[model samples]
Target: MSNFAILITRRQFAITATATSRTVAQRVYVGKPDKISNIRPLAILKNKNDSPLETQLKELQMDTQQWHHKFWMNHNKMFSKSREEFDEKWFAKKQVSSSNQSETTKMLEPEDMAIFHRNFLHNNLEAQRTYDREWKTRNKKLLFLSAQVAFQRFYFKWFKSFFSRKS
Candidate 1:
């Protein structure tokens, strides 16, 4: 195994040990759809013909900012680091034996583990390194994100209005 791969493995172990001491399985987000009480498109713009030129223009401009601010304010808090009321129970440490403690863990040797790790890195490292690379890449095709999200509130408010009017 190369020096770089060893360093990464060491760092990963260190972070996992410091942040969480369990053999914490891979972190996965379970996509659970919320139980909606009501599912209806919001009223947005009035009918294209009925609304007066000046009034519609003024309403759209004001509604757009309101929608954008509301959405962005909500989005910013997803990765919040609030410690208003400390939750130390979750961070409490637990005892963990070394991997070789059990008979099952005893089967693997340092050399074999190192070789397996190297193979794993070679096969899967590209995905692990993507976020660090995505910004640097000039292949615009690879940057599959859209700027619409920043403008989502504005766009959706207008959209909801149009769709609601049609129905």
Candidate 2:
């Protein structure tokens, strides 16, 4: 076939394939009821006030939410240190006051400068690693949160369209 004819054929084939794939992926819904008279319609109750049961359930739900909020807050505080707490201990310069000297520090200082140097280097390296880890973790959390929101929106749109077509 000529190039023009071949291109036309290929385009037609692609369009056909896409339509076939879509039809195949779509579910064939069956057994839809014509009327649901037994179950009360939500629209009928729209202008009505809340029932006592519903009011009690809503109050209980709110209480549960508050309890969960307080629980998580206390849990987080127990497990995690504030930035101010970390900075006060690690970043602040220590006083060279004689009254604050521990017996271990005094012994270590006199025995060898190499031991003190090694300890300082080890602590410095550990702090650096901790900071790097926290930085990466925060970035990862941000990326994950963004991806989750995008995925949920996509799923919501797809399901909405699919069900709307069915009905």
In order of appearance, the predictions have TM-scores of 0.21, 0.25
Encode model 1's per-residue lDDT on 62-152: one tens digit a residue.
Answer: 4543444443344333212221111121122222243423433434446655755575556556644763364345224222222332244
Task: Go through the candidates in order and give each one's C-alpha lDDT.
Answer: 0.35, 0.40
* Angstrom error at residue 73, model 2: 26
Every model: Cα RMSD to truth:
23.3, 23.0
- Winning candidate number (TM-score): 2
How many pairs of residues collide in each model?
A: 2, 0
Off by over 4 Å in 2: 1-126
What are the per-residue Cα lDDT tens digits for candidate 2 across 73-166?
A: 5434533444234333432335434444443344333324564446555655665576568656655654565466446545666898899999
Show where candidate 1 strays beyond 4 Å: 1-105, 123-146, 155-167
Task: Output the TM-score of candidate 2.
Answer: 0.25
What is the lDDT, from 0 to 100, of the residue 53 in candidate 1?
Answer: 38
Which 10-residue window in model 2 sums to the lowest lDDT?
38-47
